[model samples]
Target: MLPRSGDVLHVTRAASVQFLRPITFRVIRVLDWPTYDGWLWLDGYELNASGDAVSRRSIFVQREGLHQVQTAPQHRPHTVRTARRPVARTPVRVG
Candidate 1:
């Protein structure tokens, strides 16, 4: 399942690059959603080993490096095409 915007995610250190501990994050935006080996972009405050939020904001994590806590519900966009009906033709009166 792909995570949608405004979804809170708990990223683990094992899936991180610098952080050596579990960090809670929120899904800001999704860069790509493929059938396999897809990438996920996230942004949140940096947390210390003690799970304290740091001053650093706009922390972006992408690619296979970051992992989401849970797969957010996929918000499928509504795609419905409306068909046009044929109009009746009126005969013109010529003088």
Candidate 2:
């Protein structure tokens, strides 16, 4: 699958020989520079195990070998609360 901006990828040896050690990458953009068919250049950040970007880099890899990582859906707690009635105020006589 073609990667887009904000896509997270699992880059391994399958993608390129340069990546003997696999990496988690977050795509910043796909470079338009011309290259051989089935291969392209990517500009992105190398992500750590914690899913945080460690460094920015440009990578060249085969399109067929790129693996996209599925992100988990965020869960938000839903709660309901009753509205409170306004308090009444007493009027005082002024001299």
Candidate 3:
């Protein structure tokens, strides 16, 4: 699900995944920016359920075109599937 216009995102300090780019994850505030396709440079709000904020991160993300994956996340289980393709090809000369 996408974040609401005024929703808040909580970036816990215990987070293991490093989101180097921007994304439209749940629990994040939406802002306005001039960009095409992907999620552009927008402001992020950090807050805890107890009315306290943990940390705020600057973000820019691609909505659909780009592929997003997680490197690591504590206490969470994930399943991924990969494709197998030939790495090299050798030509044979017929006698």
Q: How does each model score on lDDT?
A: 0.55, 0.90, 0.44
Off by over 4 Å in 2: 71-95
What would the per-residue lDDT of candidate 2 be over residues 34-87, giving only the tens digit for each residue?
999999899999999999889999999999988899543455688788998999
Model 3, 2-93: lDDT tens digits are 44444433332222234543333333444577766545443554444454546665555444432323222344567786988868989989
Q: Please state the error at residue 90 of candidate 1 in Å.
A: 48
| Clash totals in order | 0, 0, 5
Deviation from truth (RMSD, Å), model 1: 10.0
Q: What ranking of all candidate models by TM-score puts the best one first?
A: 2, 1, 3
My TM-score estimates for the predictions, one after another, are 0.39, 0.73, 0.31
Could you give me the TM-score of model 3 versus the true structure? 0.31
Kindly state the number of residue pairs that clash in model 2.
0
lDDT of 2 at 77: 86
- lDDT, residue 33, candidate 2: 98
For model 2, where is the 10-residue window of minimal lDDT? 70-79
lDDT of model 1, residue 82: 97
Is candidate 1 or 3 superior in TM-score?
1
Note the residue pairs that clash in candidate 2. Answer: none
Candidate 1 runs further than 4 Å off: 32-38, 44-95
